[model samples]
Target: MGEENMTKTTTKALMAAAAFSVAAPALAETELNFWSWRQEDIAGYEAIIAEFEKTHPDIHIVYTPHEAKAYNTILTTALAGGSGPDIIHTRAYGSLENISSAGYLEPLDGQVDLSLLSKDELLGTTLRSDGKVYAVPFASQTVVVYYNKDIFDAQGITPPETFEEFKAVAAHLKDAGITPLANGTADGWTIEVMSGAFMPNFYGSDFFGQVTSGATDFEDPRYVTALGKMAELAEFMPVGFEGVDYATMKALFTSGAAAMFVGGSWEINGFRDAGLNFDMMPGPSAEAGGERMVATWMDGGYAVNAASPNKEAALEFIRFTATTPFAQMLTDQLNNIPAVDGAVSSDPMLQKVASFHSAATPYIMLVAFRFNKPTGSTLLQTGLQELMTGAKDAATVAKDISDGIKNAE
Candidate 1:
């Protein structure tokens, strides 16, 4: 009896060991690290990751959100140091070009099936000059003049149709003890938005394309005139705007302290949450009878690191994002215009912004045009700041920008 029992127990132990060995490999998890700079997007992405993990139990996503201003430098340093996240949140145009040129990004062209996305979505500013795709498009944005509807109604002011009327509206708002505009120069990027929005209206739609083709320079009279108009608007902005940061500017506009906010469509959700009645329109044309032009471009999207070890897993995550569920979540939850084709957004403001697409032009500085070696977006920012502070005039700032580019060459 003792020998029989011992033999049976040994056989059971061997069978259990073999079963455990067979299952261990299948249970092992593959983790993909995702990096992004949208702190506001953490909750949305977390939800998506949770849903993704439900379907793919063997895969995990580790999301790291960095501060917006320092994200590029941090990402570049990490990529250059030969260690970085598996998936990178890259900006369109110049930033993407810089990273792609360094061979840090994996081409999504053949690796990922982007057939579900529209051509407009796939071939945005993320497309390289060689016609290769470096990143999957996520969202698109257009710069528009967001006006406080309550203030406008109370002041009996309708939307302005011309440059003079725009200035008059600002002056009337200022006289009514309201800050006519909210602008933050401390961060420097918003100035680019201002320039991108106005420069096109003054110089015409083909202006940036011409600049990209070497047919025009930054010192063009139209550019200078745009700066002069911006300087005029600055007079109606909050006192000490030079020290205002982005948060302050947003707060000022959302809190009803300012009558108008000149920014991108990305801010629509935040404004809607503030419960303020607002409407957006393309900024007034610099010409008395000319049409307004909205400055638009692809915001950016996720890209795979060329050196990532978990390339297939990263591609799976990207593919997951392209699915209808995740694409709709991006539109509904984040209020972003999703890159996926027929991804309808329930956001009314975004729809309203999109309605102006017929009159839109590319956001030149950020989207189409590139800077020469020494000068780039930062130079343009500084020049605009100088113009605002009276440290330089329109012509001088324009010349400085042109010289910065030319001298760099």
Candidate 2:
């Protein structure tokens, strides 16, 4: 009575197991889409993604990077279309605020563990208007001067110790037929980069406090001095310097035709990739042995799209970023300061650039006034271009900035 019935039950059990296996194919691995503005760092990010995949075999990240300048439009269009990447690389401060206010980002405060980040890093991603955090900070950058080490050694000159000596060094380089500063105004942003050093050097630390507090504005005598110092160096730049764009200016220095370039720490990887021997300095002080300062800002962060279908997977990746291994890998590959703790680039130049934070000031236009009407940054950039030409004086530039930022609060 039992033998035939047992065989029939076993056959049915085998057929049921086969059917279950077929249905299980629906549970494929989760894939997270990551969008960024760092089109150049694609390889670096790929290495990062590969490392993360080594542990979480159940999840995969597909990285898609857009041109930095066009990213805003691209992201806005995607979000407006009711579709976007699962993870977004967001700009800090006002830019972050713009999208967060529109509710495009997942509020990250309690969702993502961010104990690895410093207060400043969190503050950079905080939407001021709402007082809530939205992303995990990735990097912070300083605006400092990059000088060709070979050029400096060839001319037997060290970095200047004071403002006057700074000018003297420029004169010396000029006499040696080396373009002293590769910076120029054809790119409006480079002028702002130069100000990162000039503003703190010429105006002193208190100036930011005074200007921010409404006790004074950019029209102060100190700001005029900063603009004047920028103008005074025109003779030491490349011929027809006002027409030199950022790429050409970078070429002048990287090619050894110019001695120095004032730019953001973001330039470190590019200069290194160019095979140039270079180092950075916080521009000189007002007096020998006095303090020096450079402008700095949080570069931005990794965020989860509010409507992401794979939030758990996206957040696991963010959690990996907060780990020391991931932070060090990011630092080593990107050659930029990681916003997380326990990872500093052993690359000496990046280390040196990070050292500027000891005397760093918030990048004035970006950190403070970018949200303002007309934008103090826009006013300063345009004003500096005019100051470099003969169209406007330092005082006039100073007045223009003061007027533009009067409502910048």
Please tell me which predicted candidate would have the highest lDDT against the true structure. 2
Q: Write the per-residue lDDT of candidate 1 for residues 304-335, one digit (tens) a residue.
A: 89999888777777766655566667887788
User: What TM-score does candidate 2 get on C-alpha atoms?
Assistant: 0.88
Q: Candidate 2: list runs displaced more than 4 Å.
A: 1-28, 407-409
Identify the leading candidate in terms of TM-score: 2
TM-score of each: 0.88, 0.88
**Residue by residue across 1-409, what tens digits does model 2's lDDT show?**
3999667545544443333223112224999899999977999999989877766777789999997768989998898787899999998877787788889888877776666667877887898877788888888889887889998898999888788998999999999888899998887878888878766888888888888788988888988988898888778778997899888998898898999999988888889889999888888887877789988898888888888888777877776665556677889999888887667477887878877788988898878787656777789989988988879999999998888777555
Whole-model alpha-carbon lDDT for candidate 2: 0.82
lDDT of 2 at 111: 71
